[model samples]
Target: MENDPQAQEEILEELVMALKAGGQSFILGILLTSILWGIATAQIWHYYRVYRDDSKSLKRFVFLLLLFNLAQFITIIYGAYYWLITCRLPGNYPKVLDVTK
Candidate 1:
């Protein structure tokens, strides 16, 4: 089933586009991204806390935001991919084969 992975990827891409269109899916994406952003920000905070004396290693808010957004983007893509894969069409489900003859 070489095509299965491609089909799943396509479904995920479509799900992302459709979700971006509006409603609950869009809201869910926003919430998930925001949560990721928050977590990334906290990580930055922790790093700063441990390296407060290292001026050269200090992180700027803008840079942290950029990193956080990048992480959020990746998280959203992965979430969409798996969500679509698991929420497949009923007909797409695997059918059991009878081996006994």
Candidate 2:
């Protein structure tokens, strides 16, 4: 079964069908997300630079902390996406098997 060409062909066919169904939407979503992420990153950098030169230490510290939090949040979101879509199977299968049978 491990070397079954028919099974491999069937899987490829199914993958093709699935891609045909939602491939465009998937690509568009990633593109939109990337654009928005870029814009957000740029804005964060701009704000950080603007605040970095502030004369008031308190304002600088608060802005730095806020920027750090924003960065961490963005990183968490990216990590989640990576974990969900990249690191695992395309579909959400049960991670554990019921071996009682």
Judging by TM-score against the true structure, name the best candidate.
Answer: 2
Residue 76 shift from truth in candidate 1, angstroms:
11
TM-score of each: 0.37, 0.43
The lDDT values for all models are 0.58, 0.56
Alpha-carbon RMSD of each model: 11.3, 6.8
lDDT of 2 by residue, 2-71 (tens): 3577875655555555545555565566577667666766876787678676667766666676677668
lDDT of 2: 0.56
Which stretches in model 2 have alpha-carbon errors above 4 Å? Answer: 1-11, 53-101
How far off is residue 73 in model 2, in Å? 9.9
- TM-score, candidate 2, is 0.43
Q: After aligning candidate 1 to the native by TM-score, how far in Å is the CA of 92 from where it should be? A: 37
